[model samples]
Target: MIDAEGLSIKIGAEAKEFDGEARFSRSQLTLWDRVTQMAIAAGEEAVQSAGLELGDEESLRAGAVVGTSMGGMHTLDENYDLIYRQGKSRIHPFTVPKLMPNAPASHLSMAFGARGPSWAVTTACASSNHAMGQAFQMVRSGALDVAITGGCESQLTFGVLKAWEGLRGMARDACRPFSKNRTGMVQGEGAAIIIFEKLERAIARGAPIWAEVVGFGASSDANDIVQPNQDGASRAMRAALQDAGLGAGEIGYINAHGTATAANDRTECAAIRHVFGEHADGLMVSSTKSMHGHCIGAAGALEMVATLGALRDGVIPPTINYDEPDPDCDLDVVPNEAREVEIEAALSNSFAFGGLNAVVAMRKWRGA
Candidate 1:
């Protein structure tokens, strides 16, 4: 697993891991919702990385598309609790605005002057993948010169924790992806904002190219609401490869949507095998969710960054907490330690709960 710093699985307990007060200002911490604050913070870093001052010259030409599976859930629950549990008539003045799902994108737009197109996508875990895909398209089509695209999620509230617990996917302690002794998936909260720009523009400006988002593919299972379909997942990967103008043999690493759950790990690996054919055994696959936990809507974006690092640094992150291997997930899972390899291309897979599969293909930036 990519080093999560100190992220823990707070499934049954409180998410003491997130120190909101420490991260945001008093004004923002009090008024702006948690997810929005996260988005703003992430946007700040992302823009800084691109050496961009949005709306400076690219202000009107820049855009923001942040995604979240459950936007501002903490705000909604807290307000509801004050009125119902505390018998209070008055709630926070900015209740509706605070809890709005699109608030993150709106805040990012205002903060960074991304006036081109700002919206939020709420497609469960596939949210960020789809959002990034849209931004990539805009950049590729010359609709926007730059974009702040990613997702945020703050879903570790009491109500949300109970809901996850009810679903029975909450792991006992740590997440163990593709492990024979795996129990279930755990929940995590965070945001990741990625900067997207046209290749020519970035080249002209001489900005450091991190990785090339060559292609994105999406598909809907339309069959099961929760259970993942192998054919549908395989189709997304093939489409991503096709979109990137690459063949199966070019893929060296797969940042799998391995949620550590029995059904997901097996289904995803099997789907990869189906799509890549003989190349499956030669590919390295791992799930960083075993460290960061499943950050739900933010999973895709975070994994994308991790995969980009894999391409840039020539190091493939491992699937931590992996011990015994499940025969069903028999691919080389990189095991519990990191590996240094010169991989040219990687795939970040995100198969959401509703069978919404979004896959992105990226290659190491070797310059034009």
Candidate 2:
């Protein structure tokens, strides 16, 4: 076995400080700039967390994979405004590069000097999971010594927000997942990065391992572009469990997709029922989107950060704004505040537009 171990995630500007849950940071700059800055800051933090120096031969052997759903919507919007309203003759030279979906990965690779492999994976909201899953394989197969992987997006621009509004998935107020009064997701912006290394490499370097990528499974519904497929999600979950060498009964917690949409909550609940069956009743399932809003392409990796925090701190953050429960989403959604729990292994589920379902299993790292 390749025994890849220890990962670190750095949250971006959208997250609220523990005490300041009501307010979030806002910037005059475009979302793409926010993503670039956050990636640099987080990448440095992850490397330091691993107790390794960037540009070191071993670290260079490490890899990078990033994902984004809408590429650079904000930048695109700004340029369009300049050209259309102001009658500008040409777009900025940096426009295409900065607005590219793969820009974040390119920036990361250049910053850290990771020479092994640097690429971006894009699949709507499932992007990050796919990136992380590929990184897991790279280390497991001895193709890389370590992997710095995650996803980022800044889709809160006018054009993107208008597009999401057309989808009718935007909540007028705040997200209320699994709640009877729930409406839909709120578009948010952010990025999250994680550092992954072989178990032996991390131990040799005395790295602090937060968790291990025990299992990962991904599948596409290809059934509908906008709607979710419960059957596809259930199959992916089962595959993740099997890959982890565990059974449904072994899991104590699940970080649900719970997008607060009528279709999403019900369909995801059905998927949970299909996979966990009787054990679903005992699982502490919740969606954190109620607190952070949905970060589109950035959602999966950011939620992965939350999952790792749950493992390290032994507490699961609640799905805020949950009041009256919907019979359709009748699962035990840990609502309103963080709670303590002993989570040996946990699942983070992300289902995106285009019926993409990605599930990953994580466990507290035990150094050998």
> lDDT (CA) for every model shown?
0.87, 0.79
**Residue-wise C-alpha lDDT for candidate 2, range 210-326, written one tens digit per residue:** 888888888889799999998889988988888888789888888998889999999999999999999999888989878777877777888899999888888898989998979
- Cα lDDT of model 2 overall? 0.79
Q: Write the per-residue lDDT of candidate 1 for residues 4-26, one digit (tens) a residue.
A: 33334354312355566888888
Cα RMSD (Å) between model 1 and the true structure? 3.7
Q: After superposing candidate 2, which stretches have Cα over 4 Å from the reference?
A: 1-32, 54-56
The clash numbers for all candidates, in the given order, read 3, 0
Report the Cα RMSD per candidate. 3.7, 8.0
- Candidate 2 has its poorest 10 consecutive residues by lDDT at 1-10
